[model samples]
Target: MTPPAALTLEFVSKHNVEGDLWIIVDSSVYDISKFATIHPGGLSVLLNGDIAGQDATKAFYGLHRSEILRRPQYARLKIGELVGRDEQQQNVPPDAIGSTSSIPYAEPTWLAPGYRSPYYKDSHRQFQLAVRQFVEDVIFPDAQRHEEDGKPPSQHVFDEMGRLNIIAMRLGPGKHLQGRALMRGIVKPEEFDHFHELIIAQELGRIHARGYSDGLGGGTCIGLPPILNFGKPVLRDKIVPDVLAGKKFISLAVTEAFAGSDVAGLKCHAKRVKDGWVVTGTYARLPESPKDRSVYVPLFSVFAARTDAGGLVVLVIPRSDGVQTKLIKTSYSTAAGTAYVTFDEVHVPYENTLGSDNGGLQVILSNFNHERWGLTCGAVSAQRTILEECLKWATQREVFGKPLASQAVVRSKLAQMIARVETSQNWLESITFQMVHMNYKEQASKLAGQIAFLKMFTSRNAQDTARDAVQLFGGRGITRSGMGKFIEHYHRTLLIDAVGGGAEDVLGDLGVRQALRMMPKNVRL
Candidate 1:
């Protein structure tokens, strides 16, 4: 490295109208012209010479300096150290630059009866308002005491969430609530970015900042869909209603220490008994805050195991005498509680077997399509929050006699963040629209690829946005106090991308497999 460059700029000062000019900053060259119009931040940085170049170094310091060099666009560069270089004096990658052309936004138009006004409109808005008021009046105050003691938010807060019908958003109409898992696809599609589903994702993201958002949306995915889709009518009638009524909270506990993405490899096992089944396994818990001391006992555990018939099965086991829970400390505290569960010969009645004896794999697969999508929503929302936070900090934070937002470099960073969010959001919504209305059952092969693609993109985007938000916050971002808690939540939640439904690599492989299925027989993988 040559004493580290002061700054580097890559862009054509003058070029043919159709040509792209690559500009090199630090060790990497960026195809500024190609990025010009396509830049989500805007065209200003691209059109203006060296926006992120040498002269921009005044705003540079810690991670930003290293981050700029790590952009995928610069991976092929051979240079080291910036050492204050002029625009015309650097090397630009030849093929890296492309022709100047317009890039179209990928969002699709939302169509009718499905695109009806939001479910949270009119009376629903009042409900949301009342719920928020409750959070402020009762929950927030109680949460403060827990916060002071370094404990997770109070259980009263969660109970309040249940009382507000937040937990019942999917079951049926409660307090005039009519949104179902299916209808939510419609209402959420309208709110999503060009990607369509990203909008509903944002809503979940907001609720997540406060406390346990998993049981609500996550339950709707794995919990309701499975039993409703596969369980016997008696099981549906007996279990589904309470799950919908907020009387019970459902969570899928398939991920184990050794089997993260390998669902089929889960070690949990069940043995057949005269009446039903005996299940035994250890399920890991994320962690809990110690102050409030209100224990969260997981009443429902979705256990994946190989049945005596030599086929995979999912047993829905409710907490009973045989089931035991142990609290575990974890990285995130917003989630009031998490526990390691042990089922020592826990007996689940035959009626509780969610799907056919050997068809548990299908149930698990079906549940993922929606669960991954919910994560997509949360991930995108995380980006949206990062954007808002960055803008606020830029405009409000003063440095060296001027607000940080006044600097061209800072503005450029902000713009890049905005562009990234928009692009990801658009992709999210598009996939959501396809999922909600496209009837994937008839085209399982075709739908699989799209879902996997969206999952991978959205999760990565959320992680990236969280990282950027922390950077924008600087020292305050790393702290556990004040607004820092939000940043901490975002930081710890990175696992959400990889854990929830499937790993990024797993999704990518499934996407490729789906794409392969669409190919002609001769070319199939």
Candidate 2:
């Protein structure tokens, strides 16, 4: 809809009272009167006499980031532009508005009009738009709320994701998504590729609340794949549909107190029982299990454990009689439901065993490539976001009577951050390109080492980006509220990506080991 005609400063001043309050920011006007009471910061800040009848650009930036002004909540309040500003200059072309942010490197290069990418096509673009809209309109608000409340996303959020077929699409390209209407009809199932999956991960990472991101669907992103790929057809048919539809929640139960990245070292053991298998073990701290079955379903856990044969086994254990969960608090919020799960002789039917008994290592290993790739995608996007935050903060914040961007030291940091982010993103795209062209078996053999290195490199870049971002954001960066929220949250949870998929040291070594296996037999060093 066209914005109401530009309003003069005099006209804005008249509506400054409690019931009809309006304020200007960057030459655009917002009617935030109705939003005052519900503002997360508080109502008094808006009602304060000093803010009435004035442009609130300074105060707004002081308490909130620029993204707030761009959110749909604030967008709807924007009735018009300031009277003296040039309309053409102030207005973004309709088509270009959300395609890319004005900040450099904030989005993929392909999203920028002048740039081109052979990897992305019209379907990819359509998919990106649909996912972005869904994230902004549906997921982001819930993420913000749950991030603060330390609760998982509401069922409505999951239901909406199910409706969009996002839960299924997130597993990366596969037969699972085939024949399904994806992203609510924006892209066909056959057209979905790794690039499309990458777009989803990056777009969701834009939420910037890692805990909330995990809480929303992050667990299922890594957890449900084993069941989908290796579970018996009867088992897959029984649970996969419900989980993908967001009626239930599942997690990959592999990490233990004794073993993290060293999957082979896991002590969780499965013993043969009369009818099936008896599994008993403890998972590394993860989020809490859902309490309400109607609103949520803690459906399944793909438990990886050792059998009597001294080889690994994977079981699809439903939340049942002997299963127990306790919440484990971490640096980030509890929204992720990070829990300490215990399977006390939990009985799993023989039919629930995924892949071959005592040969489940490959099943688990196969899932890691995509899992790490997803983490790499998120890490790179997050660093880009951090760079964007630094750029905006430097330009707007003043130090020693000049903008922070004017300082040579800050400029150097920004340059380094941008370079790292761009390089990682380019590498990630290249790997994704290979994924699109190669089949699953080819990817497993050819791209494993490359993906591992990419994850390691991207995560290492995140560590640097987070540190630099914290330095740039200063006191606000360390603080949780106000202008530095994204920086602070990212800094606190950056290790999740670095360590969760695979620790940097382990992955770096694994990449080298894998590459050596593919080394030429007779070539000189």
Candidate 3:
């Protein structure tokens, strides 16, 4: 047989260049068709990439630069030394309808083996480590600063994310990979019982409120991913390096004043203009709780809009400009400073448009899978904290004539919490495994629903376990010097169970839909 043809590069010439299929290398066209379907912004973005290819490469800053580098699963592609003009050639349109293939990818050489992980054999495991280190070291410390500044923690926390390479991990070294692959590689479920994940979350949760919030979603979870997922290369170049380095910050602005889970029903709109787009709408902020004596500050948010070329798309309009943020204080996430942000004709450049116009819904939804999984991880950790705290109390605190450990009722509750943690953590790992291996097209399928359900389940269980721990502590539990802080945190975590990726009812419905899809046709009820 003839030697296998070299994996030749396809390029777009003056004759045939689609709107999104080609990229400019130096001066000539370079076909990124292989990366088209796998693009985090969805296929439409790739089409637009073709149209904006030259300008995209030339962009120095803004959202467009950020999106280009945010591919969720891009760690798999090799970053080859781009050849000069001599190797450039015309792109050959494939007879195939869409995308090059449907498969998960592997890590690139840039993520060398020596980097430090026992679970490197599994991509999901590597991803989990990335998230853990990021939250513990960078995000948490920033939250502590927010506690002092009376402002939300986004600015400083995100600035550090850019430094640690955490933000870059999503789309950093490999450009050819897809989101599903990176997600799966980050954390595999079965690796730990649900309780194990909970144990980690609990340890992190022990930090002050700001620290915990930042570690969870205060920055990394809500900030970097979206920009990376749909923003153009111009946006990517400006934002990613900074956010990864902790120099900048960003956040998701999907939950509206009226709409919570019904993303498709958003009322926000972006009117098109000659140079760019203008977004106008209101975002709600949480009201502060009296129980929380700590000082609280608020933040404005960017909003999502639908444009002529792209449907349901999002933009990052800062609090300083035409945008306004109203703080809606709540009992939870005191460190986060929840708020409702309203936009009034916020101008966004043509290049600032993230992903394809009207593709915002898909862009936002596609990213939820990871967000949900992360919440589950955090929730599990919260439960572990409850167990650890209860254990400490049981061994020391006297009950009646004996230590609480001798009480059957207390032991029952502690054991139950541990059991629940185990169940949730194991499920989390299993789901993580499936995520790493999941095909591109199937990313939003039944498995996505599983992630949602796990998030709901884990969050609820974590809340309940925390409550039980406080109850078990009896008198000491209610005091600030005793379990007071833990009890305060317990209530705070309950709110998280319903928000980050989705609410319980929403995830339940999604799980139902997924279950229905998995049934055989003849088995209809």
What is candidate 1's CA lDDT for residue 512? 91
TM per candidate comes to: 0.65, 0.87, 0.64
- Each prediction's Cα lDDT score? 0.56, 0.82, 0.54
Evaluated at residue 5, the lDDT of candidate 3 is 28
Model 1 Cα lDDT, one tens digit per residue, 1-525 = 121243333222232122354444434333445455565556554334544333332222212323345457744433343445557545343312111112121111221123343322443333333434444455545654553344545555555545544444432222224433323232331232212223333444543343344422344445666776777888777766655544555556677777878877777788888888888878763332322245455446567777877777888777688877776644543353567778798888988887788888888887776666666666766666556656756655677878878888787777777777677666765565555455647436456677778778777766766677777677767766544456766677566566557888889998998787677776644
For model 3, how does the per-residue alpha-carbon lDDT over 347-442 read when each residue is reduced to its tens digit? 877776677777777777776776677667666655655566567567556656687789899889978887887788668767755655665467
Cα distance off (Å), candidate 3, residue 429: 0.6
Residues 257-308 of candidate 2 have per-residue lDDT tens digits of 8987789998998998878899888886434235363322266777888999
lDDT of 3: 0.54
Q: What is the number of backbone collisions in each predicted candidate, taken in the order shown?
A: 21, 6, 80
